[model samples]
Target: MALLKGWRYGVFISGIVGLIGLAIYPVVIDPMLHTDKYKEVQKHNRAGVNQEAIQPGNMKVWSDPFGRK
Candidate 1:
């Protein structure tokens, strides 16, 4: 009764704390620990060599034998 209720409460609190930690980690810890990958991606994006060409009226069609188009 009481013991089960206390255990549930503890688990709930722990889950909330874990979620908060996960939310904070990407915003704070990740940038501090790993900066090289982000910088490289940013530089690549700025270089303008990875852009994809999209033409008007160009649509991809997939063949499906089991279902409708």
Candidate 2:
């Protein structure tokens, strides 16, 4: 647009570049740099989920009280 010119154009272009970098950072850079750490965190999360899956209380969280599940 006419409003985007000179330094404004630089700012606009830089903003677009920043957005692209952000998208690529998560999808490409993170997997390349931190895949092992991410897998470890996922493993821990799954372990925690399985550990607390059968919550024991007056209100059951994941388990069926009548043993239907």
Candidate 3:
């Protein structure tokens, strides 16, 4: 019974520490690692409305192919 109690206490402390680490990691670490991708996604979402007129991978995407430029 004493051994079981000690095991339970160990598990309980470990679980609390894991939760605290997870809570802090996102606020302190994830942003630094993921900011570029996050910003790119945001920029893409904002520019989605203009995509119809400017297809990707084309240098003269703004101008039509038939000498519109």
Candidate 4:
């Protein structure tokens, strides 16, 4: 195995620390601050309503066709 020296080792160590921070941020910090906002958004939405919101023509650019356009 090759050995790292000086600033190269610092860079390598910092990269590993950054990756660990990223993983922890989502699993810990994000949920604490954003969970309520997520639930509020979910209140107006539903799963398995895929033909519309989750798919094509559910967007505002499409015509509704039933005079709702």
TM-score of each: 0.49, 0.49, 0.43, 0.48
lDDT of 3: 0.69
Tens-place lDDT digits, model 3, residues 1-69: 345468788998899999999999989888667777666676676674675555657555353222323
Highest-lDDT candidate: 2
- What lDDT does each candidate get? 0.68, 0.70, 0.69, 0.69
lDDT of 4 by residue, 1-69 (tens): 889999999999999999999989988888667877666666566444544554555455433222332
lDDT of 4: 0.69
Clashing pairs in 1: none
Model 1 off-target regions past 4 Å? 1-5, 48-69
Candidate 2, which segments miss by more than 4 Å at Cα? 1-3, 39-69
Worst 10 residues of 1 by lDDT: 59-68
What tens digits encode model 1's per-residue C-alpha lDDT throughout 1-69?
355467788998899999999999999999767877676776776575423344335555432223345
- Return model 1's CA RMSD, one decimal: 12.5
Window of ten residues with lowest summed lDDT in model 2: 60-69
Per-residue error (Å), model 3, residue 37: 3.0
Error of 3 at 31 (Å): 1.0
Using TM-score as the yardstick, the better of models 2 and 3 is 2
